[model samples]
Target: MAVTSVIASEASLFLTPQSIIFDEKSRSQAVHVVNRGNRTGVFAIRWIDHTMTEEGRLFTWKEPDKSPWSLQPYVRYSPRRVTLRPGESQLVRIALKKPYDQVPIGEYFSHLNVVMLNKNVEESIRQQEEGSEEAEAGVFRVVARTGISIPVLWRHTRDQPAAEVEISQWNSSQQTLSLQVKRLGQVSTRGFLHVIYQQNGKEKRLLDPHPLVIYPNIDGRKVNLSLANRALAGGKLYVYYSADKEHWDKPLGFASIQL
Candidate 1:
C-alpha cells in the first residue's frame, strides 16, 4: 500500500458581475473568473441552493423537500471544471431552462460556487516516494481547499419587485441600529441601503451604502448597521433602499428615526 499527500496553496480568485439575474426575456448570462494568485488553480464550478438566516448568514439547503425558491432544477453552467494559470481568466456561461407552464411563477435563487481542489497529484506521489525534507523536518503539509460563491437569481417576469425597510430597534450603548427589511411581493429585491443623517436641514451620509437583498422564500431579514457617535447626537436618521441609480426616483422603501 502507498500513501500520498500534496501541499495546498491558496488561490486569489476575483469574479466580476458579482450578482447575476435572469429574466423571462434573457435566459443566459456569463461570469468572468480570474485567478490573481501566483499558483495554478483548478476549480470545480457548480450550483448550490442556499437559505439566508435572519442574521444574514447563508446555509446550504439540502432537505428532502426542496425550497420553492430553489433554482437548481432550471439552471445550467458550462465548463464544470477548469484549470487556470496565474493571471488567467475563464468565462462561465449560465443558462436557465424552466418549464414555465408547470412551475409556479416567482423568483428563484441559487449560488454559483467555485471550489479549489487539491493541486499536483504527480508531485505529491513523487514527494512521498522520496521522503521529502519537509517530512524529515516533521513539518506537516495539509491540503486546505477554499471556495467563493455568488448569487444567481431568475425571475419568470420583468415586473418590478418591492420591499420595505424600517428601523426596528436602536442600541444607543452599542451605536448600532437594527433594520427590519420586509419583502412585499412574490419576487425578490436587490438594492443598496443608504443611511443619511439630517440635522437642521443639512444631511450627511452615515456609512457608505450597503448592498441589500431580500429573497422570496423569506419574509424579512434583520440588518444591523453601526453608526458613529457624532452622527447620533441631535439629528434625524433616514434610510432609503433603491434598486439602482436608474430607479432612484422610484425607491423600494424608506424609513426614518429621530436621534
Candidate 2:
C-alpha cells in the first residue's frame, strides 16, 4: 500500500501597506501569512526586531516576550498556533502603540517566521520504546524545514540633503578589470567604495578611496586602476560599497576577465 504524507506548500509572509511611514504619531498595521500549499500546515508566528546600536553592536528583540528566541525566552504565541487549511490563510495584527511617536527617523526592520512541525518525527518517536530498535531510527530521521524573510523599514525626516555616487568607467588598462557603482534612490551624505581583486588564489585590495560628497542623481565619477605592477592579468574582481568604511555590503558587482 502506498503511504500518505503531509507536505507544506510554498508560502510567504509580508507586511501590508508594504512600507510604513510615521511622523511622530501612533500607527497600526497587519502582517499576513498566506498558505500556498496543498495541505494544511501549522505556523508559530513571532516578531523579531533587529536594531543597530550607537556603539556599533547589533541588538535584537523578540516581540511580546522579554527574552529572545535565541536566548530561550518563554515562548508565547502572538497569534497563537494557527492552522491553515489548503488555500486558507491568516492575518497577524501588529500595533506600533507607544514608541512609534518617539522613534528616531531611520529604518526599523522585522521579519515573520512560519514553521511546520514534523508530524512524521513525532509519530516515530511515539512508536519507539526507550530501548527499542525503532528508537535508534530517530537519529537518522530527516525533517523538512523552510523559512521566509521579511524586511520592514521605518524612516524619519532627513537632516541633511542627499548625495549620490556614480562610477562612469572602471577598468584595468594592462589587465582585464572593471568596477562600477551607481547610487540608486536618494543618496546619503557620505559613503565609501571598495574593490577586492583575486588572482592565482591570492587576494589584494585594488582601489580604496574616500571620495568627496557626491551630488544627487549626477553622473558617476570614474576610477581606473592599471594592473601592470600587480600582475593581475586575469582573475575575479569583487566590488562593494558602504556608508562606513569598515563595514561593506555584499559585492553587488562582479566581473571575470582574462588577459
Best by lDDT: 1
- Candidate 1 displacement at residue 55 in angstroms: 2.1
Estimated TM-score for each candidate: 0.80, 0.44
Per-residue lDDT tens digits of candidate 2, residues 136-248? 66665466765454443333344332323333444555553434444344322235656667778987777664432222323233444454566555676655555557655
Model 1, position 69: C-alpha lDDT score: 80
Q: What total of clashing residue pairs does each candidate reach?
A: 0, 3
Per-model CA lDDT versus the true structure? 0.79, 0.46
Runs in model 2 with CA error above 4 Å?
1-26, 49-77, 118-140, 158-163, 172-259
Q: Looking at candidate 1, what is the lDDT of residue 130? A: 88
lDDT of 1 at 138: 90
lDDT of 2: 0.46
Give the lDDT of residue 13 in candidate 1: 72
Which of the numbered candidates is closest to the native, going by highest TM-score?
1
